[model samples]
Target: MKFGYLSISINFARQIPMLNPTTGEIALFHALLDLKNIDMNFPSTTGKKKTWADGFDPTSATLQLYSGLSANGIVKAREKLKALGFIDFKSRGRRKSTIYKLLDLGSDKSAFNSSDNSVDISSDISGDNSSDNSSDNSVTLIKTKQDKTNTNNTSEKSQATPHEQKKKFSADSVEYRLAMYLFGKIKQNNPQHKDLTESQEQKWADHIRLMIERDNRTPQQIKNMIDWSQADSFWRQNILSTAKLRKQYDTMAPKANSEWQTQQPRKRVYE
Candidate 1:
């Protein structure tokens, strides 16, 4: 069959042996058939890569099909092909290129004939006991399918919760949590230093944000007030220090208190 510019052929048999370009092995016919969807590309003598997109390019397709083989497998496959007189390859020099040519298999056509014989055998077997053979095959297929379904369900159930999953799936999210924890620790240690100037507070916030973004939350051991504020202690001190500083600086500044006191009057006894 031809789809677009790619051609596909299938040869079925009880034990069909052929060279597997992908794995460079002698495998059963069914195994090759299973790789029907793989895309292949080949290089031409003109040193240009060919593809199905440009009409039929079997040479490029064949080379691409063999590209997946391991180095050792490729060597073995080439040797086997040489022995069978099916293909020959030559290399000119260390840095030079190689060339390949296909040879006829002659009268050893039994390899291709096996595919036809297998079809006859299948027909004979099916005709002799059609109902019983079909029932057996159906039961086996059902069991295999059920086993796969159960395994997938078990896997899904073992998955983690969203919060836990997020932490596991993303290193950045985990770092964010650690940064929050470090800020909490910082705030806890600097209860009295809650009145940090605006610039100082902004600097610490920016640092925490950057650490979270970079996913670098390695803990440091410095105990200085500023260091503690940058560590995980910032969270704890945020609320307490904000309230205290507001009371001290906004409500009870000496000048503000004096003004409030002056505005108050003393009661006179004239009645």
Candidate 2:
């Protein structure tokens, strides 16, 4: 993108110490602001607020370039910002760019301090009636016995949930594995395909889950289809994604069965 400038308020900068978990996260946070500012400065015929009310809609490509992080790294940074209540992502739909909201960080500022990194959401957020804020929104709070002197200790102790030992979403988990498997298949078909960010990778996994749960394709069947399609030149490029597979599953399943049946030996002499 063109050279965009960022303007951060003093209060927003102060909040970062308690919120940002990594250097990439800090970059992402600023990148969003820079994008919004760019929108604000650009001369538009439509006299709107420069950006959408929610925030700027940045592509995975834009974020990767802006933050200097890979697809996997960008996803983790976005997650960290969301977990800290600094940002929120709003999905538009399939093949649509996602909208991001720079949340009211001031509202949750008092919850974070030099002594403790934890945010008490139960007390900060509203009643249970408003709990259904989003389809994916969930609230959980964990408090750690913190010492005022050591800031590093507080950062280390900050966990997503009280019982969870590791990050909620990990690269080694099933979700990421599914993503990578499909990603590799796509790359195999189209050797010149561009790299995908974590958001796009997760979308691939979600499509796979849809195939398994909604289309009733077994995991083994999906694996078989992946191998069969990639080995076949005509269908290799056609079967680009799980979403595409879901669309053709009904047709392909029967064809797969027919091919398997034809491959078997014929007992013509016995007949």
Steric overlap count per candidate: 17, 0
- TM-score computed on alpha carbons, candidate 1: 0.21
Best by the lDDT measure: 2
Residue-wise C-alpha lDDT for candidate 2, range 81-165, written one tens digit per residue:
8887766776677577777766554344332221232212211222242243222232111111223366653333211233332
- lDDT by residue for model 1 (1-271), tens: 1111011111111011333232243321111222221222123466653322222212323443534554455557657655654444564554543444332232233332222211211122122322332322220000011233455433433223455333322212222222333333333343233434544433333443332222222211111122223322332344233222212222222333243236433421010
True-structure lDDT of candidate 2: 0.50
Clashing pairs in 2: none
Give the poorly placed runs of model 2, Cα more than 4 Å off: 1-9, 43-46, 51-53, 108-271
Q: Clashes in candidate 1: how many?
A: 17
Give TM per candidate. 0.21, 0.34
**Evaluated with TM-score, which candidate comes out highest?**
2
